[model samples]
Target: MTLLIRFLRLILGTGVFVLVFGGVELTQPETSTRWAVLGGTLGVLLLLHVWSSPRRGTADDPHPARMSDGKPQSGRAKRQGARPSELAAALAACRSAFASVALFSGVLNVLMLAGSLYMLEVYDRVLPSRSVPTLIGLSVLVAILYAGQGVLDFIRGRILVRIGGALDEALGARVYSSVLKLPLKVGRNGDSMQPVRDLDSVRAFLSGTGPTALFDLPWLPLYLAIIFMFHVLLGLTALVGAIVLVLLTVYAERLTRKPVTSGTQAGIVRNGLTTTGNRNAEVIAALGMGGRMAKRWEEANRDYLAEQRSVSDIAGGFGAVSKVLRMLLQSAMLGVGAWLVIEQQATAGIIITASILSGRALAPVDLVIANWKGFLTARQGWQRLTKVLTVVPADAEPMAMPAPSRHIFMQGVSIAAPGTQRLLVQDASFALEAGHAVGIIGQSGSGKSTLVRALVGAWLPAAGRVRLDGADLDQWSPEDRGRFVGYLPQDVELFAGTVAENIARFEPDADPALVIAAAKTAGAHDLIVGFRDGYETQIGELGEAVSAGQRQRIALARALYRDPFLVVLDEPNSNLDAEGEQALFQAIVSVRQRGGIVALVAHRPSALGTVDFILAMNQGRVQAFGLKDEVLAKLFPRPQPAVAAMPRLRLATEEPAPPLGAAAAGE
Candidate 1:
């Protein structure tokens, strides 16, 4: 638009100059003057047509797509917004966009300069020609020069439009890829929606108005130089006009920027509400709290409206200033041109050409100043993005993985946070035969889950090494170790996809029959089939639509889908009702029957009734390890009743009930 508008003005100004000056030749009544007047008028009309022609930019619309439920889909619906690397990636894209525009601008200015020189030659030499052939030839050469300038201008405009889109794609892909690599902890941190909002801001900065503004920065000086070379006075006038306009724009922007800042703050508050709204959407709907949420939304809307008004007010001021400046500059340029003509210092054609070039020179600068807000916005966003690249991941020494096996050993094992002596679990020494089922029982926060995490290599033991089949776990490759062990954390997370997809997460190519079999064994087959699409039905984010028991079943199915050698379930029975708990017990039995090792953390003895061995934890220490009855007796000493005297079982008497809650929240 900028390029086209300036070029049109160049055409109109040139034609007006020739038409007005050619009238002077008619008054002279000389044959030479009459021929010059007719020749110049024809040349000016050709230039006008060439300059005024349309120069359209690339016009592809934005259509961002994202992957969901392991399937590609289109929308702005992104998971866990941009990561730290994503921000840096956006800046890199912006830098590339800027460079491309600079190149285009250079090409444009060179062609424009060539056109100016050609016009200067025609005015000084060709207009004086008496021969018709000479006039015709000169006119043809000028037409070719204008045509070349027209083509260059068209290309420049197209490049700007296309570059923005290319930059957007590059930035989006990098940010999305970075988000995939971001540590789960950081991506899942904050109010659960922080990642989405932050990433969106980064995306807007890199792919929005900001990159376009950056691209214009290089064109400002190039255009300014083109005008300055025409005539020093005209160049100085345009430069001064630019300075004054810029100052006025800045004042206007400052007024607008404050409201935008307030709007951004209000946006943050609205985002917070939206996040909270999503988290409690169910409760809100069920409890009929629509009125309350609506009221909050109304407040946010009101605040946004006020900010909008402030922005509009400032924009109005800028518009008024722009119109006044345009009028003033136009008056000044004509006045100067008329003065120069009267003084016999310059020809009418030179004065006219300078006037046309002046507007073109100042055009890009106006654009740059108008878009200054975008640059600042992108900069702020860029800094935030840079911070992501510097975020500290959890410190862990890289070590070779152990040999692949289900057998796990903990020799003098202890797990503790850094800079603290408070061991969550300590002095835990145990060994399990390949394919053996071991049950862990303890009070709340007695390191039951911690022990499971250490066993699965999520966290390394602070004081001891874990061994797999006599090889140190640290000696094995992470991938190799992972292949041998499957971990199911306490709170199960499911992607918004089919039951089959969730179950086959580790193996996208796994047979659907196998997935169903695994789901059946996990006790989720019946419930999944009840959905409208059965295994193909969509599950909302985190499986919010499903019951906690169903989520656990799906998670179990997922763990089993890969048929890992060792399955570690922490508090598997926490969310399950009686039937679900029984199903879990049966699932454990089935695993053991199949010669697979199963490890579980449970607080209730009844929950571990199907397990072969029990490991009791107390205050970060292993109190006992043996068969269930033997370990239970040691952990909670009591008199044995007649019914509890069986070798495989024991009844409690004169013993307090376990104080710990029945839960084993795992990682």
Candidate 2:
């Protein structure tokens, strides 16, 4: 498509050039200067086209990076070892589209001369000669040029929109992946969604008029040159206006940069508050804290608006000043042209022509000033996206390894919370073989959930290794690891989908039989069947439609789906009642019976009934690990009767002093 657009532009440019060249030759037979000017302009445009053209990748390149949609990397990108950021690579992929837009802009800017030339000919040629046919001819030619200009402009706009779309296609999934993984790397913060919003801002700027002004900026020199051909004074006037506008643009940047940054920070805070408030709506309402939350949000929003208003005022002020200055400059060119004509140094036609040319020259500057905020936003977004992609580099596709069924081992594993150095589990060395079910028991914050998370690769060990069948967890790709490792987090959160779909992990081609089988194994089949749509029942967002126990049971079904080799359940029965607890117990026994390893993190002793082994943790350290009865006895030894007799003897001795009636009389 890019090539086709380029070819069509080339053909149109050639045809227009031939027509204009012939017309100029016929109209001014003695002047070779016009020919030189036309040739130079074409040469400059061709040079820009070549400079903007897309580069192709080659096998011999030292550093290679994937382009949008997995296209070959551009050989021109010579970054060594480190791959180019995803945003950069994606933009490089759209270089052809950009080149095409540039070419179209060149053609359209050249055609912008139609109005000036038509005015010049009407004043200097047709009116003086009273030639009606000549006037008609000039109008026809200008009309054709204007039509081509409009077509090229439309094509340029379309290409820019597609470039934005292509960029989104290239980086959307990667950005979303970063959004998910960034918390694990940098910890969850207010700006978790910033990357995605940044991407949207970039795409929006590309698809808007901001880039059109940018593309037309380079042609300012061309217009100024034409005005110089008319008269240096007129050209100098336009140049001064352009310089002032450029200065205004720079000033706007300096003035708004801090405010834009502040506004973005404020927006992040506001959005975070909104998200938190929405997530805990019930608590907020029940506690009558809605007004307070709203107040906080309002304060954040007010800050954001203040910053935004500051930026807008600066941009609007500069835009208005530039627009007025540009108009005044055009009028100044006319005044200068009229004086030159009066002095018999130039023709009457030069008056109108120079004014139009000068205005055309300054139009881009005016546009850029007006859209300065958008330009800054796009630039900032680009910088942010580059940083994020750098921070969380793309995952390398590791070589496939066979599924593990032997043992899960943690050799001196130390686990820390994401984005923090505080170790939650330290030197926790342990191993569980196939068919072994270990219940991870601990007090609150003893790192039972943290340990199980490491076992399932949700959190990586800061020190030592987590190995599955002798292979480190990092050796397996996430997709492959997920197939063998099943994890139920302490909080059971389900996505919005049908019960069967959730059980099947939303696989596009999930089998109904397998889904039902997994549900039955998790002991959620009967409960699910009781729903209005049975397995087809739609679970609302976060499984809000179901009760807490139901959500937990459904999550258990999801974790137990496909009979994963390593199943890690973190407080899996937290919300389960007696019946749900029984089902969970049976599910653990079922996993063990199937030769699968189970690591269940639970506070309730009843939930550990089916486990063969117990792993006790305390203060981020493994307290004990052995048979369930042995570990339990060690952790909670039975009280001796001799020790219990002391308190009873003291109580009996004190109570023997008085009966109820004697106590009342004494009182």
Best by TM-score: 2
Model 2 scores a C-alpha lDDT of 0.81
lDDT of each: 0.63, 0.81
Q: How many residue pairs clash in model 1?
A: 12
Clashing residue pairs in candidate 2 (N, C-alpha, C atoms within 3 angstroms): none
Residue by residue across 123-242, what tens digits does model 2's lDDT show?
887788787866776676567567667766777777777778777877899999999889888788895788999999999998889899999999899888888877788888888988
Model 1 segments beyond 4 Å from truth?
Answer: 1-100, 110-174, 177-183, 187-230, 244-269, 287-327, 347-352, 392-403, 409-433, 443-483, 525-534, 544-548, 593-595, 613-627, 640-667
Q: What residue runs in model 2 are displaced by over 4 Å at the alpha carbon?
A: 1-72, 77-82, 643-667
Q: Model 2 has how many clashing residue pairs?
A: 0
For model 1, how does the per-residue alpha-carbon lDDT over 418-510 read when each residue is reduced to its tens digit? 335567888899987765688988788788888888888776677988877777765655666666677788767888876788888745477
The alpha-carbon deviation from the true structure for residue 489 of candidate 2, after best TM-score superposition, in angstroms, is: 1.0
Please state the error at residue 370 of candidate 1 in Å.
Answer: 3.0
Per-model TM-score versus the true fold: 0.66, 0.90
Worst 10 residues of 2 by lDDT: 55-64
Report the Cα lDDT for residue 484, model 1.
Answer: 67
